[model samples]
Each structure stands twice: as C-alpha cells, then as structure tokens.
Target: MKKRVEHGLERFIFSSRWLMAPFYVGLIGALVLLLVKFVQELLHIAPNILSLKDSEVILAVLTLVDLSLAGNL
Candidate 1:
C-alpha cells in the first residue's frame, strides 16, 4: 500500500509539470508578434531611407539590432 501511494504521488508530480505548457505557448505567441513588428519596422524604414537624417538612421539600426538580440535571447 505504501509503494502504491508513492507511485501515484510521483505520477501526479510528473503530470503537473505540463501545467507550464500554456506559459510556453504564450511566449511563442509573443515571439511571433515581435517578428511581425520587426518586419513592419523594416518596411517603414525602407521607403524613407534617403530622406532620414543620420541620427534617425542610427536609431533605426539600433532598434533592429535590439530586436534581433531579443529574439536570440
């Protein structure tokens, strides 16, 4: 009887780990949103590249680099 109870408890603990699935799914959704924003930013910058000031261009480049670093993390 003690061994059976122990086995059940172990199984319960293992199954409970799956409760984190939703959190992972949410993170993946966030990543997809980030990618979409990144692409949108690129499109926004491409059209006005010639007219942008040097500081504005630097800021845009840094924003892209920051997003890339975030995706890697």
Candidate 2:
C-alpha cells in the first residue's frame, strides 16, 4: 500500500509540469508582440527625426528605451 501511494504521488508530480506549459507559450506570444511594436515605433520615428523639435525627438527616443527595457524584463 505504501509503495502504491508513493508511485501515485510521483506520477502526479511529473504530470504537474504540463500545467505550466500554457504560461510559457503566453509569455512568448507577448514578447513577440512587444518586438513588433518596438520595430513599428522605430520606423515611425526614423523618417521624422529631422523634422521633429528637440523635445519631441528626445521624448521619442525615451519611448524606445522604455520599450526595450520592458522587452528585456
């Protein structure tokens, strides 16, 4: 009886790993979306860099940095 209980507990512990799979997939999806946004922001800023005022350019650069930090996390 003790051996049977031990075997069942081990099986449960092993199978529990599957429960975490969805979380991993979700995190990957979010990161991919973040990357897409980052590229979009870069493209948006590039062509306008020369026309933008100093303050506006600074703000745009800061926004890119923020997105980069978020992706790293």
Candidate 3:
C-alpha cells in the first residue's frame, strides 16, 4: 500500500510539469517586450544625449534591468 501511494504521488508530480509551460511562454513574451523597450530607449537617447537629463537615462536603464530580472525569474 505504501508503495502504491508513493507511486501515485510521483506520477502526480511528474504530470504537473505541463502546468509550467504557460509560465515559461509568458516569460518569453515578457523578455521580448523588454528587448523592444530597451531598443526604443536607446533610439530615443541616441539623437539627443545632451538634451536628456542624466536621471532619465539612469531610470530607463534601471527599467531594462528590472524587466530582465523579471523574465529570468
């Protein structure tokens, strides 16, 4: 009986791997968005680096880093 119970529990755990598929997909989507945003920010800064305040650049970079961390998680 104990062996049967262990076998059932193991099967349940293994079957649940599919449940994480959606989460991984969502993470990929978020990573793509982050890449787009990073590129946008770079484009925005390239033309008028002097016009953009230092804080603005820092904030944008920080946002990119935050998105990267989220995607990695």
**What lDDT would each prediction earn against the true structure?**
0.94, 0.93, 0.82
- TM-score-wise, the better of 1 and 3 is 1
Q: Identify the leading candidate in terms of TM-score.
A: 2
How many residue pairs clash (N, CA or C atoms closer than 3 angstroms) in each of the candidate models, in the order given?
0, 0, 0
- TM-score winner, 1 or 2: 2
Model 3 misplaced regions, further than 4 Å: 51-73
Candidate 1: worst-modelled 10 consecutive residues by lDDT: 64-73
| Candidate 3 Cα RMSD (Å) | 2.5
Model 2 — which ten-residue stretch has the worst lDDT?
Answer: 64-73
Model 2 TM: 0.74
For model 1 the TM-score comes to 0.73
RMSD of each: 2.2, 2.1, 2.5
Backbone clashes in candidate 2 total: 0
